[model samples]
Target: MSISMKLSRTLGTAFTGLLLAAAISTTAQASGDSVKLEKQDWSFNGIFGTYDRGALKRGYQIYSEVCVSCHSLNYVAYRNLMDIGFEEDNVKEIAAEFEVEDGPNDEGEMYLRPARPSDRFVAPYANEKASRAANNGAFPPDLSLMVKARKGGPDYLYGLLTRYQEEAPDGMELADGMSYNEVFPGHQIAMAQPLDDDAVEYEDGTPATLVQHAKDVTTFLAWAASPEMEQRKRLGIKVMLFLFVWTGMLIALKKKIWAKLH
Candidate 1:
């Protein structure tokens, strides 16, 4: 091809790519957030607070396959997962997926025990291996409550994960040994997109796209932040009811007490 023709072709390809990406982002944005959680701050109140279980389960699968390798959720317990709607039998079965060293038979000797519902989810690497791997020796953040901690919480969490380009943007500085993240705590984060299109199979009907994974995982993190989401709504209703009744009674009492004076 002539030099001028080649240049034109390359520029056309670049423009086409940009337009396609914008179209996709626009469509995903239009799905209309199902949960009422704010998109700009990391609080967890929302319409359902509970979303697609399939999404949560897919997120758990992704975490196990990708994220758990370098993070920890020491605050979580297997039993606490009853809140996730896991039955007792399944919880124990899931917990037993790991082995723990427990004091043997009250004799003060240690033995390997199957993890229980009360046991914390295990970190993938013992310690040093995890540190050497990512985030410049900083442990990859335990994502259990990540959505809650991040501003824009769920929406930002989802957007950041799925929004990677095949290469870093021009003029961006990524250290020789580090990676690029456009929207991380420092913006010069050590982690890259741990997830992207077709990285894993989606058991849920959610399309096997990067954004879907982000949405699913964000939903899972939201659940971890407040497993009592349903309860919070129920209690909110009860409290509002009690306040209404009490206020009415007080108004009636004031009227009765002041009848003669009035």
Candidate 2:
């Protein structure tokens, strides 16, 4: 089928899934908070609490193996590895995995070597057209900055990966170009659930569970989206410490300056 046709189908499926999810949400709200198996989403600072590190690590593995084939994280940098807890050697080792080409100026410059610690993760395809052609005109999005781009990003992403379901036996009506994503826009998605527990080796010793893998990848992607996370955290800490010290000095200065005046 044409790329447009496939995209239309995917969009239709997504729309329906969204509507179903909205209806379900409405019913739950009207019925009050007595629903079973409350699916709590992970967060950096949750309405419930923090996200899991092991989950994030496993998620990175999953992305490296599965989704990376179609999506690209162009916005992430090679140096951000330290924030996600990779050491210098591991970071360099990771950077060396991808070969990036560079060359000198117009004077018969020599080509650069393999990818370094500073280059972004390469896209699986060159551009949108290329990506679409490969996936029946469905544009596999660049994922580097996606977590920041989308609403409820991590939660949305995590849920989407795990929400594939079997369609009802009855002929289900979907949009012009969508599929049934029980957890997607139309509660039906054209892309099948691309993952299962033990989809990749859980090198971190985390249990081989779908939920665990999703969460980990989400975290990794989150870091990839903002390689500056560690720096941000460090800056925040330094700012806090500076404020505390500065406030103490201000109070002491005030006491000294007001002593005789009072």
Candidate 3:
């Protein structure tokens, strides 16, 4: 046999072995305790994708009205709401609704004042200890980076919010105060189901269903995690375009130089 023919056969056998190993690994994972996460078709999904303004507004409403009691968005400020199409005046009004601790007058005493656009979102508890105490020793994590922190990002979050079961499967025992959630690791979670149908009325007349709330909130948190995503994608596109043009020019120059040598 020719050397080239032998090399091709060897390469083909190695590729076949690699494929078989990958298939076995995937089957093992599928048979394990890992839960299959549901993927969502997010508006901000591709290089040209941008956040849905309507969803952002509705998500902010859901977070403020429903999730705010336990989770806090410490990284997001009221002024940032303008990115989601909120007017400056509306943002100010939203900020004013919450009081933040700020002070030290001539008397040197701290006092509570209405929050400003520059201030971060307020925590539900005074501190970590207080937060844990309030929730039966389970601390609620800040939602500011939750989407980025989790394994499946927005998909995992949306699943966690909407996949809660009223009761565990037969023969499964849930610890006291724990909730059953198929998407949550261990099929149990410290936090109970946060959203219900009609949990909050949407100002834009969108359906106030549990699934809708989950999607909107996931989008909002995804935005909060990476507010500059659109800008970054734009820069990437420009860079790619420049590289393509530069490569074509280089190729043409190389051909022109070789023709002179010939």
Candidate 4:
């Protein structure tokens, strides 16, 4: 082939490849988040983002009442609750509600005792077998890193909690235990709709609607996944400011030092 003809063919192929990649990306994004997933207004999103304390507390309440039955929050300790605005005494009281497996009194046998603030969040099932049995052979995942694990983060979780439907969409067929959820990766999820209106009594005047509960729980889970987000952001700001001031000082020193040479 002539040089120009060869170049034209290469260009055409490159353009075609780019178009194909863009199409695939669009399809993947549409499948993941298009109609079903709604973006949430989170307190902790941008550079100055901070957790919404009220929403965090309410989210914790939902997790305690509903999610704890199936999911485990093993990475979280009772003391961590204080980060979300719980008083120290209240955190202690909440921790004490659960019995934690502890010591082998000299005999090397494990025993159960009241949980403390230092104790890790208790798992509902004794073992994986027990947990799977309770959920009809489907293992309930740990909630500790759920928000981070998901692609869409908190919004995807919120959508899953609120978007379950009894009937599958027109072309979809669901397995016996699976239900339809718009935002779930494959459209069929084992988990049923977890929250309903008035499922839990809200201490704050916020109405206990399904959407509200989902939003609160999403906030709580987001905080769980990144409790140090605020600290990290703050540290980052301090470092940037230090660098800026240091750079100015160095520039001035460079000018003063060079004045002698000039």
Candidate 5:
């Protein structure tokens, strides 16, 4: 074959491969989105929205009491709890509940000490290997950015939490030790149903239903993922107002100049 013909054939083959890959990717994404997620009315949904402090606090309680056993919040500090409405003394107490590995002392030994407000949230396991070993070779992902990490955000999380099935559908054979979840991509998940009716008693008199637990925890995770969302929205509103005012002034100034010229 001539050089140009050979080159043309190679280009055609590459183009075909690219088209095939694109089709496969699109099909996979469509399949993934086929599972319709149920949306909840969140407190922080709109431009003027802000995090609900009550929900955040409840979510933290649920996370601390249950989810903390498997998942870690690596990015959040105990001090961050104060942002969600906990008092400094309460935060200090919460931090003291967990032990963290401190730096090497003059004796050149790493020592265990109570976690402080400045310290990051402690992981349940020291490392990935240990975490997987404890959970039957499945690694529990960190919850710090989970709200943002998943495609449907809080909606996906809420569904995953509340959509657990006691048994898999009649035809499907589930893998050993895996629980059926309607929202999970494969319909099988390693983590069993975490919430039950009245799983965490609410100190604030909120009903401790399973759905409430899911909602509160989702709200908390959303806040953890974007603690600055409220501030950002506030700043954005101010900037938009300034731009509107500036544009109005410019329009008035233009009219005045044109009138004087005329």
Candidate 6:
């Protein structure tokens, strides 16, 4: 056999072995011992994808009413809501809801004042120590980069929010302060079930179901993790188009130049 034929067979065998190993790893990850994250259809998924304004708004409401008590979005500001289609007046009203620490004028003492658009989201606790003390030593994580930090991203968040069970499976004993969640790592989590049906009234008349709240909150977190996603995708598309045109022009020029030699 020719050298090229032998090389092709060797490459094909390596690729087949790689695919089999991947399949085995995936199967192991999906076992009962491991967490199974649910798959979700996201609006901001593709190259041209943009956030759903209504969903994002509802998500903000969910995060505010439910997640805000424990988790903080330190990276987000009221002004950032404008990118999600919030009006300037509404952003101001929302900002004013929180009281932030401001500098003293001449007394050299800090004073509490209503938040402004420029202020970052306030934390329930003043410091990490306080946060851990409040939650029985398990620190509540900041939600700003939670989506990007997690392995499964939005799907993991959605599944975790909606996958809580009242009782653990038979023969599994849970420790104090721990809750049962099949989707959570080790099937145990420190946080209790934070969401429920009809937990919050939706202004858009959508049913405040558990799944809806989970999905909306997940979408909001996804947006928070990548606020510039839409702009980046747009730029990427433009770059790809330019490269395609450039490549075609170069190929045509090459053919025209070589034709003279022939």
> How many residue-pair clashes does candidate 2 contain?
29
lDDT of each: 0.71, 0.71, 0.92, 0.89, 0.94, 0.91
The residue-by-residue lDDT of candidate 6 on 61-149, one tens digit each, is: 99998899999999998899999999999998999999998888589999999999888888888999999999998999999999999
lDDT of 3 by residue, 1-262 (tens): 9999999999999999999999999999989997889888999998898888888889999999989999978898889998889999998999999899887867999999999888998888888899999999899999999989989999999999999999899999999999999988899899989999999999999989999999998899999999999899999999999999999999999999899883
Compute the lDDT for candidate 4: 0.89
C-alpha lDDT (0 to 100) for residue 54 of candidate 2: 63
Model 2 worst lDDT run, 10 consecutive residues? 33-42
> Per-candidate TM vs. native?
0.72, 0.67, 0.92, 0.84, 0.85, 0.92
- Per-residue accuracy of model 5 over 1-262 as CA lDDT, tens digit each: 9999999999999999999999999889787635789889999999999988899989999999999999999999999998888999999999999999877999999999998988889999999999999999999999999999998999999999999999999999989899999999989899999999899999899999999999999999999999999999999999999999999999999999899883
lDDT of 4 at 43: 86
- Give candidate 4's error at residue 8 in angstroms: 21
Please write out the lDDT profile of model 1 over residues 1-262, one tens digit for every residue. Answer: 9999999999999999999999998888788443223253323445434455677677776776777767777677888777766689988998998888777667878888899898898766566555666456656767678767876777767766755445567887667555555455444556666888877787655677876667767777777766778777878878989999999999999999999793
Task: Give the alpha carbon lDDT tens digit for every residue of 1-262 in model 4.
Answer: 8999999999999999999999999899777645646788888988889888999989999999999999999899999998778899999999999998888879989998999999999999988999988887889999999999987898888888888887996888888888898888778888877899999888887999998898899989999999999999999999999999999999999999999994
Off by over 4 Å in 5: 1-33, 254-262
Candidate 2 residue-wise lDDT, 1-262, digit = tens:
9999999999999999999999999888788632122244555643323335566666677888999888888877667655566678877888787776677658868665667778887678878889878876578777877777765667667777666655533777754445555445546454556777888877867687887777778777776676656556667778988999999999999999999893
Q: Which is superior by TM-score, 3 or 5?
A: 3
Pairs with backbone N, CA or C atoms under 3 Å apart (clashes), candidate 1: 36-47, 40-152, 41-152, 79-117
What global local distance difference test value does model 1 have?
A: 0.71
Model 1 scores worst on lDDT over the 10 consecutive residues at 34-43
